[model samples]
Target: MHYKQLSQQIFKKSSYLCVGLDSALDKIPSHLLKEKDPIFEFNKQIIDATIDFAVAYKPNIAFYEALGPSGWETLQKTIDYLPKDVFTIADAKRGDIGNTSQMYAKAFFESLNFDSVTVAPYMGSDSVKPFLTFEEKWVILLALTSNEGAQDFQFEELQNGKPLYEKVIEQSQNWGSHENMMYVIGATRNEQFAHIRQLIPKHFLLVPGVGAQGGSLKEISEIGLNKDGGLLVNSSRGIIYASSEKDFAKAAAQEARVLQEEMKVYLDQL
Candidate 1:
C-alpha cells in the first residue's frame, strides 16, 4: 500500500493499531493441535476477529521459521488469508550484501506478497538499497528498539556526539523518501520520540513494545504522532494470545477493540 492510502486508512478508521501475528506453536490453544494445520487455523480466527479494529498486521518471521517446513506453509497460508485492504508486514530483520538482499526482498515482497519487511542496517547502504526498489513496498529499518540489548549498540554515542540510532535515521532518510521507507521506533523508547520526531517528522514509524512489552500507548501517541498519524503501534502476545481456550479469538478481538477505541480518542484530539 502507498503511504497516502495508509495514512488515509488510519484516519478513516480512527486507529493506527497494528496487530502482530506472532503465533507460536507451543503457545496456541491445545484444541487446535487436533487440526491438520493448527498454526493457520489459529491465525485465521485471529485475523477474522481483529481485522476491523486494526489497520495492519505484522507476522514476525521467527515464529514461522522455527517450525521448519510445516511452519513455513502455515505462514504462507496465513498471509494469503489476510484482507488486502489491511497492510501486511513480514517482520524479517534481513539485510546483507546487495545481491543477497535482492533475494530477500523478492522472497518477502514478490513471493509472499507482504507490503513491507523489517530490515537491519548494520551492513550499510548497499545492503539496504535492494529492498527499496519495489514500488509501494517499504523497508522498515531498525532504529531504537525496545529490547534491553538495544541499549548496548543503538545508544552508543559516536565521536560526532549523536547516538548510533540517530545517525541511522538521518542517513537512511536520504536513501528513500518517506513514501517508501520507514523506521522501527519502539514504543518503549518513548522518551526519545521528541528527538526522533525532529529527525524524521513525516516518515511513518512501525512501533512495537506497546502491549505485552509494557510500552504505554498514551505516552507514544502523545510524542510520536505527526499530522499524518505516523505510527503503527503493534501488540503481539497481548492481543493474539489473550486466551488459550475456545474463546481465544473473541478475547483477541476484545483486546484489539480496546486499543482501537483508545486510538479513536487520540485521533479525536488530533
Candidate 2:
C-alpha cells in the first residue's frame, strides 16, 4: 500500500495499532494442536476477531520458521487469510550482501506478497537498498530496538558524539524517503522519540515494545506522533495470547479494541 493509503487507513480506522502475530505454537491452547494446521488456524481466528481494531498485522518469521516447511506453509496461509486492507509485515529482520538481499526481498515482497518486511541495517546501505527497489513496498529498518541487548551496539557512541542508532536514522533517510521507508523504534525507547523526530520528522516508525514489554502507550503517543500519525505501536502477547482458552480470539479482539480506543484519543489530539 502507498504511504497516503496507509495514513488514510490509520485515520479512518482511528488506530495506529499493529497486532504482532508472534503465535508461538507451544504457547497456544493445546486444543488447537489437534487442528490440521494449528498455527494458521490460530492466526485466522485472531485476525477475524481483531481486524477491525488493527491497521496492521505482523507475523514474526522466526516463530514460523522454527516449524520448518510446515511453518512456512502456515505463514503463507496466515498471510492469505488476513483482511486485504490491513497492512501485512514479515518481521524477518533480514540483511545480507546486495545479491542475497535482493533474493530475500523477492521472496518476501514478491513471493509472499507482504506489504513490508523488517530489515536489519547493520550491513549498511547496500544491504538495505535492494528491499527499497520494490515499488510501494516498505523496508522497516531496525534502529533503536527494545531488547536489552540493544544497549551493547545501538547505544555505543560514535565520532560526532551521537549514538549509533541516531547515525543509522540520519544516514538511512538519504536512501529512501518517508514514503517507502520506516524505522523500527521500540516503544521502550519512548524518551528518544523527541530527538528521533528532530532527525527524521517525516518517516514512519514501527514501534514494538508496548503492553507485555511495559512500554506505555500514552508516553509513546505523546512524544512519537507526527503530522501524518506516523507510528505503528505493536502489541504481541498482550493481544494475541490474551487468553489461551477456547475463547482466545474473542479475548484478543477485546484487547485490540481497548488499544484502538486509546489510539483514537491520541489521533484526535493530533
TM-scores, all models, native as reference: 0.98, 0.98
Name the lDDT value of residue 168 in candidate 1: 96
Model 2 quality (TM-score): 0.98
| Candidate 2 residue lDDT tens string, 1-270 | 899989999999999999999998898988999999988989999999998999999999999999999999999989888877889999999999999999999999998999999999899999999999999899999999999999999999998999999999989988999999999998899778889978888888999989878899999998888878899999999998999999999999999999999999999998
Tens digits of per-residue lDDT for model 1 on 1-270?
999899999998888999999998799999999999998999999999998899999999999999998888888999999988898999999999999999999999998999999999999999999999998999999999999999999999999999999999989978998998989998899789889988899999999999778899999998888889999999999999999999999999999999999999888888
Clash number for each model: 0, 0
Stretches off by above 4 angstroms in model 1 are none
RMSD in Å for all candidates: 0.8, 0.8
Q: List the residue pairs that clash in candidate 2.
A: none
